[model samples]
Structures are given as structure tokens and as C-alpha cells.
Target: MKFTKFTGLLFVFMAIPFLTFAQDWHVGAFLGISNYSGDLTEQRVDLKYTRPALGLLVRKDINRYLSIRGAFTWGIVAAADSTNSSKALVARNLSFRSNVFEGSLIGEFNFMDLDEKGFTPYVFVGVAGFGFDPMARDQSGNWIRLRPLGTEGQALPQYPTRQPYDLFSFSFPFGAGLKAILSDKWTLGFEIGLRPTTTDYLDDVSTNYVDQNTLLAYRGQKSVDMAYRGDEVTGKLTPGTYPADGTKRGSPDHKDWYAFSGFTITYRLGASSGWGKVKSARCPVLRP
Candidate 1:
């Protein structure tokens, strides 16, 4: 009986945030571009590979300055070493394209109350779970998935410490935006958010190269062919032209990151009870 009483109190304690039944509710869509930064990008984000992204979001305003938002986004991210300015990197000839789908729950804070000011700058921080499948075009111009091949020697007998990376990972999403009230029922916003991930294999090029012969023997010819491609560019290249086995193919110290930037438009369902201003028995007012 005592335990049950304690549990009931704990439930109510946890339910304080959701007591926001008296707040405002909003639903919206995000349309924008997405890009990635990794071994293939020399900078933080490579613009050349930017691709269209789309998302749907629902928000609940806990109060005038704070809100909770949930969103689902889909986008494309890709890059190629061939686009590098350095001949050595270009000859390395690594490339990958991946479709990323992310779902996030975030807390948003407005610097100024949009309800009173009509416009405000906002910031948000969130946690997201995202999935991506990296692919590269084969010599035949067909796209091939990269994971099962274990291009980095994952799951091979010789390197027991090298484990396969999961296709899905958790990311930290944080960014800022500007919001303006368009009307009583609508709002317009622009936001840029970045998701830094835990995995280094988003491009499937992290760590050193596996022995080409061993990779060829265990994972088959496709694995060896995709693992190293220096020969493909320079005809009749010397055997050692490929990064010799156990050499750096990518920096394991650095992880990959992807980002989304776009415009958001939201519609207000209705103001929660007691959230609106008391009219003081005054006349009609403009859309608040």
C-alpha cells in the first residue's frame, strides 16, 4: 500500500510538463537542404553535395517562451574524394551517397515572446535517432551498399577489435532560428540544425585498409574492388598505388556529421484555456 502511494506521486511529478494542456499546439512542415561533413568533406559541410530534405513537425508550447517539438525528417547526403582539389585525394577516389531519416524531440526557447512581440529569435536542442545506408556506384555505374562488404576489415578474423557499425545511430541536434507571427493562426520561421553522430562510417571510409587479398578472399571480389580504387582512375597503376594494407584510409579520430536547414510554417490549432489575455470586458482586438 505504501509503495502504490509512492508510485502515484512519482507519476504526477513526471506529469508536470504534460500539464501543458493549457498551452498552444502547432503543426508544421520543414522544407530545406541537407549536407554532410566527413572524410570526403574538407570543411565542416560540403555544399556541392547539398540535397533536398523534407520534414513534418508538431509543437506544443509549454508557455510563452518554451515549447516541445517532435519532428521526422528525410534527406540525402553524399560526397566524393574525386571532388577534392588535391590530386592525391582525388586519386584515392572514394565516394558515397546515403539517405538519412531522422526523428527528433527537442526543447525550443524563444528569446522574446512571439505572442507579445510578433517576432523573436529562437534556439533549440534535441536528441535524435537516425538511420542511414551508405552506397557507392560500382564500375558498372550501379549503386551498391557498403556495409555488408566490410570495407574497413570489420568482422574479419585477423582484426577482432574491428566491429561492424550499426546503420542507425543517436545524434545530438542543436541550432537556432528566427520566428515571426504571420497571423493569429499562423507563424513563419527559418531554422538551421546540425546533427553530430557517433559513427565514423557514414561514408564507410574510416580507419585503415584491409589486406586486399584477404578482403578479396573473404568478402569476395566486390569487396576488394570497392575497398580500394586507385587503379580505376590511373590506368595500369602500380600495384602499391593503393594505400598499402594497414595504411590510413581515413582518420578514425574524427566522426561524421549531417545537417538540415530550412523554412518552417506552423498553424495554431487553438489557444489553451486561460492562456489568452483577459479582455477586461474591452472591445475587439487584432489577431493576437
Candidate 2:
């Protein structure tokens, strides 16, 4: 009971800031492109393409040099075969549209103190947690079916042949942005960012499979060869043939990272740092 209580308290402390940010959030919508650069790129996948992301920021200014900010963002991410000719790659393309949700705690640093500033420039760094889901489409435009990779080791009821929810994963976040003082109370800005994760399959390109009959049979040379076929570099396969041994199961072997940037418009509230309304310098001499 003591352990349970302690754990509950810890979770509450972590959630307090997130709850506060939701109430007085600074909402903004901006569009920018994102792409992947790790293993998925080497496996003939299109991981880099035009994508857009949107986010909201909730900030608390601590002082001239530091402050805290929380944010939430969602977007589409993909990668392409950069080595292949654009025309050829498009003809034989395999792409997944993965959705991601991320939350971050950022620290702001002012290079020029508020008192010495004409234009204040700042930098930030932070950690974040994320959730991602990858989906693929067939020639008919319907999503293709999938099962978790390596689930063969589990029992039938415990391991589904095809389940949609298996593709989600968590990640670590880091990024930097710049802010400029437009007025005593208003600021403008832009930012670039990145998130790294331990999961190798964000595109469902990893793992292999065997056809239903061969898989259930669980024996013989034919099924063995079919299952291992996914190991081939070319990934060549006949549509109706028994599943190859190398038939991929999960997301591809690639690093997941995206780049995004946009302008920020901010309105400050309070009297600190000349943010309040300027009073008239010429007040008539008080009562005679």
C-alpha cells in the first residue's frame, strides 16, 4: 500500500504541469514538411516526403534567462527511396502514413538579457514522450492487414495473426527554436525539432511470414523456403505464392526523425519587463 501511494504521488507531480498547460494554452496552426533518415531509408522505403505538423505551446516565464514551456504536436511522417530514380520509385512504391502525438517540456535561454535587448534571441532544449501508429494501403486503396512480428513464439489466443494496434511505440524528444522581441509585450519566433526512438519498425517493414496453410502446417521444405524468402535483398515475390520466410512483419528498419518550423506570435501578460501599458509622462500638476 505504501508503494502504491508513493507511485500515485509521483504520477500526480508529473501530471500537474500538463494539466495547467491545457487550460491556458497558446494555440497556433502551422504547416511544415517532415521525413525519416535512418534504417528505413536503406531498405528501399520512402521515408522522406512532404508532411505537415500542428502544435500548441503553454509557457511560464521564470526570468530573463530561463522559463518552462509545454507543447503537443501531431503529424504525418514518411520516407522515400532516394537512391532510385523518382519515376521508377513511384511506379513500385511502398509507403506508410504514420500518425504521431508528442508532448515536451522545454527550457528557454535568452542570449541577450531583457534589459540589454534591441532584439532578444533565445534557444531551447527539452525531453518529450510520443505515441505512433503506422498504416499501409493496398492497390484497391484499402489498408493491408498485418500481424505483430515475432508473435509466433506465443500461443494462438495470446498472439493474433493480424492486429492493428501492434504498431504503436514511444520515443525521446529534443529540439531548438528562436524568439525575437517585437515589442515590450509581443514576440515573434521560429523553431526546428527532432525525436529519436529505440523501435526499429515505424513503417511495418520489418519481420517475415508464411502463408496460412504453410504456417499452420508448421513443417516441410516448401513452407521453410517460403518463410525465409523475406530475407532477400530484392524482396521479389509472386502474389499468390506461399509466404516467404523473409516476409516482413513490423515497421521497417529505420530511424524515425522529422524536421518542422514555423513563425510564432506571442502576447505577454503582466507588468514585468515593461510589458504593461505606458502611462502618460505629463500629468497635470496635482490639485492646487
Candidate 3:
């Protein structure tokens, strides 16, 4: 699905639950850094490509130890094989950057009572859906969208086995956090979460390199050129030299992963009353 359509659906999903249950809500915003691990990154988490991330979240408390949250996050993730220490990766010279839009529904489990919290550590796990469009810079310095170009010969008759990847995919978000209640109405926290995605093409460099001639015929010359970018680094375009068909372009054995790490500040909404009192009153008294 298109990213815009997916985003619209996410907003609607977030709105419905909030409208239905108006009490025990905590609205917050977070600021952090984001990164990804994939083919280009080769399992190493690098800080050089870390980019700023921000998000807005809404939480509904089920109890002092349990709560559910919906959040919308935006971030940038990028990596380059050229930056790797491995000679093979440096010679491959592949790279891509993508902006990520994600919506997550997570359940948080606090280790201690959150109602009268000074500080409590928590863990969370949930499902998330995100959209991305990976882009690479061409020789002319123009950023080219990789999906339409089919750099790996995807969706072409010649390579019927290689299907095009979805622009939007699902992921599992799991992580831990620490929160400190600043007042009855305010809280501060820090969290680090990892999202393991089902898609391998987050960096647009997965699977084998297709025959350049086949890609040129099926996906055009742009596919042929982008499919094998080693020449960009070598500066020598040897005729008929390309990654042979069936050669590994990426390790298909593993999937991509992205992460968000940072701090959050939340404001409590609606004063506790009646049944809400029983829920909020379970905590030990706060010490001065």
C-alpha cells in the first residue's frame, strides 16, 4: 500500500480507541535517535548513520503494572557498505537511505507500582507496521528510488522467483524502559526499543544480482546500472563484468531490524475518581 494511505489508516485506528475510552490516558512526546541493521550494515550497529527520531504516544492504563500504548514515530535510517571495514563490502559499494513512518500498539509491564512511582523500570512488546522507500544516489547525484528500479531483478519474468517487496510491512517491537513520576500529573522516562521486521529489503540490497542483460531487457538500463554499482568505486567498467547470476548480493538468511532510543515526557489526563480511585490507590505512599 502507499505510505500516505497507510498513514491515514493508522490515524483512524489511533483515534477510535481514544474516543471510546477517554479516562486513564497519558499523552506524551519523545525524542531520540534511530538506526537499522541490514545487508548494508552487516549486523553491526553503527552510530555514524544514527538520525534524529521523534514520536507522539497515547497510553491507557489497565492497572498500575500494565498499560497499552499507541504511538506514531518518524525517523531516518541509512547505511553504506562502503563504510564497512570488509574489503568485499567496500568493493560492493552499495548504500541507501530511507525515511520511516511507523505506528505501534504496545503493552507495557512495569516492574513496580507506577501509581506512586519515584522510578520504575518497565518492558514492552507489541506489533508495529511501518512504511519506507529506500533511495540511492546515482552517478549524476540524483537520488533514485530503488523499488521501482528493481535493482535485484524483482518482479521480472526472467526472475520469476524474486518477487517485489512490500513498501509497508509488519514488525515486532520489544524493549525496556525506565520511568520516574515527577508529580501527580507528570512523568519522565527513557526507553530503547528494537523492531524486527519481516522484510529484508529495508536497505534495498537483498538476494542475488540478476543478469545485467536480462535486467536491461526487462527492467531497463537503470536496473542494469544500479544492480551492480561496484564500478562506481573501482572506476573501471570492464566489459561484460557484472555479478554473475545467482551470486549473492545479500545474505537472505536474516531480516532487517531498526531501533529507537530516547527519552519521553508524559502528562496525565482526567483526575482519578471512583473505580479509577481503586486502580490508582494501589500504590505505596510516596516518600518525601
lDDT of each: 0.88, 0.53, 0.86
The residue-level lDDT of candidate 3 at 82 comes to 73
* Tens-digit lDDT track of model 3 for 1-288: 699999999999998876666557989998999999989875656787999999999998898799899999999999987788787887888889999999999999999987654679999999999999999998899999999999888888887888889999988999999998777778899999999999999999778888878888878887777777788785343333587888889989899999998998988876632332545657888999
RMSD of 1: 5.9
What TM-score quantifies how close candidate 3 is to the native fold? 0.84
1 or 2, which is superior by lDDT?
Answer: 1
lDDT string for model 2 (109-198, tens) is 777654345456677777776666655544456653223322222223333553333455555555566666676656677776666765
| 147 Cα displacement, candidate 2 (Å) | 5.8
In Å, residue 286's CA in model 3 sits off its true spot by 19
Candidate 1 has an lDDT of: 0.88
Q: In candidate 1, which residue pairs clash?
A: none
TM-score of each: 0.85, 0.60, 0.84
lDDT of 1 by residue, 1-288 (tens): 999999999999887655545247888999999999999888998899999999999998888899999999999999998777767667788899999999999999999978777789999999999999999999999999999999989999998999999999989999999998887778899999998999998999899998888888889999988988776775433434556689889998989999999999988875533213435435877896
Top of the candidates by lDDT: 1
lDDT-based ranking? 1, 3, 2
| Model 3 spans > 4 angstroms off | 1-23, 234-240, 272-288
Candidate number with the higher lDDT (2 or 3): 3
**What are the per-model numbers of colliding residue pairs?**
0, 29, 0
Q: Give model 1's TM-score versus the native structure.
A: 0.85
